[model samples]
Target: MKFTTATPTGAGPAAQFTGNVWFDVIVAGQEPSRVRVNTVRFAPGAHTFWHRHVLGQTLHVVAGVALVGTRDGVVFEAHPGETVVCPPGEEHWHGATPELFMQHLAIWETDGSDAPETTWLEEVTEEQYSAARTRSA
Candidate 1:
């Protein structure tokens, strides 16, 4: 067994997020592994740009309310301890609701080669952000 050093929290890139967001890399897999994990924190009104994973992605809410939106105008509201999964190549975006801060562990795997695990598209516009609504479970 081996202990991995911890990396300090870093700001999420402006190209990928709007408002205040931070992330700490928990696991950046090495050879023999293709998985990657990050603990992400989003301030109220903060969110990611539209993006998709090459393999897929899973998000486990750690605190506050999480609003996850998709291309088809569906938004999923996940509370603490809830897990949201995005299938491979599905365009989606997720972040904190406008009223509170939120945190989640973002989990996904690399394609295991040179291809990026995620492809980021345009940012979610004001109309999109305000249109978030809970879907029937």
Candidate 2:
């Protein structure tokens, strides 16, 4: 196998993320392969807006702690080496804790058609974020 060309790290769209967040595309398969992988880094207190995947998504924590929350107010706490999965069409958000930076590998698949693979929803409200922060492990 040959090495793939490198691409620059890119910041998440301001419309979909809060604070400073960046990501590197690790792999984006071509036709006959729907796989996509990204290495995402989140600054302390930074996070993604609520969104859902058409084919589902998986996250493998690489460093620090990751907080993943659902519309129902459930927050799943994941630390380095842990893996988290979100089923197709489940609205959710994920990011680092207020005290630490975090990184995770996001893995997902695009639906094999022209339709978008993700549907981004509203931003995470400050109230919801605070509520999640107060949650006990």
Candidate 3:
């Protein structure tokens, strides 16, 4: 068994996220192992852009409240200890609700040999975000 050194928390890029979001890489497997895990923290009202993983993604909420939205305008509210899964190629976005900060561990893997791990698309429009907030209220 071996212990891996911890890396500093990094800010999520503006191109990929909005508001204030940060993440720490928990594990990024070496060659032959495509697994990736990250502990992400989002400030109230912060969120990721529309994106999808090649092999799919799983999110385990760790604190506060999480809001996950799909392309079809369905937003799921998940609290601490809950897990949400997005199937491969299904565009989605996740982050904190407007009232509280949130944290979640995102786990995913690459599809197969020569496959990209993630595909990032456009940002979530204001209309879509507002709709989600209305639904949550």
**Whole-model lDDT per candidate:** 0.93, 0.89, 0.88
- The residue-by-residue lDDT of candidate 1 on 5-75, one tens digit each, is 99999999999999999999999987788889999999999999999999999999999999999898888
Where is the poorest 10-residue window by lDDT in model 1? Answer: 128-137
lDDT of 2 at 21: 97
Candidates sorted on lDDT, descending: 1, 2, 3
Global CA lDDT computed for model 2: 0.89
lDDT head-to-head 2 vs 3, winner: 2
Best-matching candidate per lDDT: 1
Off by over 4 Å in 3: 112-114, 132-137
Candidate 1 segments exceeding 4 Å error: none
> Could you estimate the TM-score for every candidate?
0.97, 0.94, 0.92
- For residues 48-84, what per-residue lDDT tens digits would candidate 3 score against the true structure? 9999998899999999989888888878888899898
Could you give me the TM-score of model 3 versus the true structure?
0.92
